[model samples]
Target: MEVVSEDIPVVIAFTPNYFVPVATCISSVLRNADEDARFHFICLLTEALPEHMQQLLNELVGELGRFTFMDLTGTLSADIYVDPKYTIAASYRLLLPDLLPQYDKVLYIDCDMIFRNDLSELYHRVDLDDNYMAGVFEATLEQQLAHMQVIGCAPGTYINSGLLLMNLKKLREDGMVAKFLEAATQEGLEFPDQDVINQLCKGRIIGLPPFWNSIRTFLLPQYKADFLRFYTEQDWQTVQRKGNVHYTGPKPWKTFTVAFDLWWRYYFKLPKPMQALLIIPTKLSLLAKIYQTFLGKTILDGTRALYRKLKRNEG
Candidate 1:
């Protein structure tokens, strides 16, 4: 099934810790890609190499067949430190704006994603008219705009940060990246990196259907349509058509089992005994979380996810 690079139109993703699960998800998508447009998938790691991780990374690279690696701190223009408070996942916010220049149109996926089909279709779907950037309509563009205003960006622009197909050429030409960095600084009211892109590219960015980034497609509770105007049906019609499933929420790693059971299948040539050990804990954690997710048959929502903190506070 593997062919030489195939000179595919590029797709990029970034991950810290060199996650094997995410790498598997990414590879699965690439494997199914059209030969005409093979994938140029690139990923980044945010930390110094640990011996175990180093070996794992090597194994990942070997199994990947074709992919690129970029060390986080090594590639940045300047050292970015968001309040040393929470081990900030902020470097990605800083790095993305700068990294946008390196390619034409890049698909930047979060580490917690899986690929259901060849990304070539989505890559082709990006239509940059009206300054719109493609992503789901969840918390619709209107709500996204409200969030943007809070962060000092023009309203009506906000995209889900999880999986972004960025048009780097357009971004550079419009001076959006510089603007994003300025808006994203520590002193300048902290907004997530995804919000910045949504704000800056509002109105002009196109909206992809909800299926491409189906945050709650399978995981969340389902509901029926209005049956009158056909509006809800329209959304479902759009949803029925898609090629990828993005598992973007409290992942199975913290819980007893990941939502999509599909993520459990990724692997390398590592010894079976070693894999057995790794998967066992991963599965156990997922199982334990399923109970934790439930508060008497109702999945915990919002602040309840911070049960540990609640205990500390109570203590």
Candidate 2:
């Protein structure tokens, strides 16, 4: 193993269709990083990333540190049950211990988020010596009961897998890959890899404040009561001050919200022409909202059903 260096190794996994948000995510990090921050990015993908995108990534990370891309096509087991909403790319983070043996620890974040402050604090300050990984709690104790039962984890320990400070050395020593594979084969796993991680690393996960991976819903009046009960007052202040926003439910390009506005603030940093192309989803979402408001979901569902039936008949 190489000597543990000060440079942070940050990992992200995404598909081709998510390039816009990927770029935006990276941009937020590069732009907001502290002056002394140094990073090494490892992007995992299943398909061959286009050269232009690779070049753009290089340009984005220029002089900051290295930006490496690994195509992980066919890397996951065929038997691993991937949820319909997620692709095989979702499991690519599981390969980190093997793929990045040189690094003792690494930060893995989803591409659907943007940083509000320098990540140096997270990469340097968090102690993962005794734990396999550290992450923020994803739900209230009541809400986590079902997931905890599914994964056999204790209450308040179930974490959102979106942002993680992974102790790769510990995971490698524990042979986590095999354990993950075994858990992947288990029945009644709703969250696929997330369940596997929680089940395998139970009682070993260090819980961070929710600010680090603040979902937009936490800011809503309906959820804030539960959010406050689940987390500390400092956590709420940290999120309010400056923390990365995770677009867990609705993406910014497809909907408008305080969190989406934060996303747009960073996204607009890209060239004007490309920005135009990215807002198409927002336009379509607006149109859908208008259609639903006037005609209702019943009409929309019936229309979709009729369209699908017609297509099937034509086929």
Candidate 3:
């Protein structure tokens, strides 16, 4: 392979239940990255990964880069709030500064996403300055403003923590790790770790373009106004070409979800022998095309109703 880029350290955190998703995530990165791009993945696990899975991950990387797993089974505090859709391991990202003391900068990506292009540009080009971390803003600011304000974060600055360009050196120097853990465990903090980061890192966080974390919510036709309210036409156009699809709610694995086929392509590329571990039920595949149309429409209708209700209460 030709070498043209510097080594970029990427961090990902997951639990035993997310092994297949993590595998797909890694596969996408390796498959889509530039031929010259080099990466070293440091994955944080909530428990000891099975030996066979570890070997499979190693094989997945092959000569493209390195894959290292850090088992953190007993280190986390149990009090952190965990959403029903996610596992307790989601909060593990807060420990990155302490966990990887060697790197001043690292890219943290959630396992539920897939890359459309090489990450070298995003990794090497972002300027963090004195900020603790940088990430794309979550879409639909109007609907989310009240909730953001309740958490003490400025409406426009609240970002989705899924994809982050972290300045570990600054985070460590400012003692943000301890602060993050403390805030994560606090009661009534919606989104747990994400709320803590926004609440505490206010004024010190950087917001990147939407393509880095393009959530499924952006595609809802009912939210056209909301989408334009937060991002420019140019931003939307760019995302269409290069967005790293984030499967936020209703993951492709378990439900009929938009962009499921994009994810399926990457999973299908994984070693044929190991592909069986990640197969979806035959019923889901057979019915996916039939329900694809209504699934999105239903979600939009429900979201519109909720938006109207929120507007009435605010009025």
Candidate 4:
């Protein structure tokens, strides 16, 4: 079926390497959405997808929703600084206003996430009357304040770009795309695209509730202090209420975590052959992590014993 203008347009950007996870993401969204819900996915690609993968994506999109694959290779200028940690796809969201000018608004979601709630609620309920975009605030006030300073924006304006609701008309009218690209070229940002979005949008962004873009902060103990430093009890409760889960740290596919099962529940829905190919690398990666941890522990234990013996001899 053709995607009508009335249907919500959701955008995701990723390289060919993340095809499975992106497929899983779309599958999860389809599973959670209402039967009558309509969505048009705009997949901005940094590289060409494999034939098998393209077939898989087509099968998934069949009759459920509409999708458009956009090749963004060689679109960005050489001067734009891309973080080594991320692919060029990470910056693709910056081009939406220019590439998709027909749409008034579009939702940009990261491939490393799963949808647990109906997206229609988010699409229709949030009012972007005067803002360029909407997103959940970053988890930490300190980080928010720091980034705000970096962009010279006020406090409480920093937001995560992982799941963004962009007002395309407003963005284009304000010339934010050029501004963001200019900032990217000049600044040494840790998260280049995200920093540019938060910096440029500033007070123009509407703060969505935490439920909309809940990062998996509760899963890691090391992050607890930072999480608590920013999020309140109510914020944690919102996360529990089942919104979009951003698998930020170690992806569930690569290792076992609190949310690994949740991710696998959707992964198993894929074709059996795909399951076989995907699980092997994930299991091997887990084993590799375990082996590295054990080796480091043994080396530390041996060093500690030698240090104690030396201390005793000195005594």
On TM-score, the candidate that comes out on top is 3
Task: For residue 180, give model 3's deviation from the true position in Å.
Answer: 0.9
List all candidate RMSDs to the true structure: 7.8, 8.6, 5.4, 7.2
| Tens digits of lDDT, candidate 4, 1-315 | 244866789899988778889988988888988877878988899877667776777777788777788877899999889988888888889888989977889899999988898887788889999899899876564545665676675654568789999999998998888998888886478789988887678778888877778777643334556656566667666676675788877887776444555676677777765555564475644543443455844664566558757876897
TM-score of every prediction relative to native: 0.65, 0.84, 0.87, 0.83
Put down candidate 3 lDDT per residue, 185-205, tens digits, no spaces: 877666888888888888887
lDDT of each: 0.50, 0.78, 0.80, 0.77
lDDT digits (tens) for residues 210-239 of candidate 2: 778887755543455667777766777778
Ordered list by TM-score, greatest first:
3, 2, 4, 1
Model 3, 261: alpha-carbon shift in Å? 1.4
lDDT of 1 by residue, 1-315 (tens): 222433333334444433555555655665556656655555555554445654554454454335555556554334333444322443454345356454556666666666565667777766754352556544333334455567555432345566666666766667776676665553433444555565556666666655566554323322223211222555565443543555555555444323333454443333453344344465454544444434622553443446646776787
Task: Give the lowest summed-lDDT range of ten residues in model 4.
Answer: 284-293
Question: For model 1, what is the alpha-carbon lDDT of residue 111?
Answer: 60
Q: Which stretches of candidate 3 lie above 4 Å from their native place?
A: 1-5, 287-315
Give the range of the ten consecutive residues with the poorest summed lDDT in model 1.
222-231
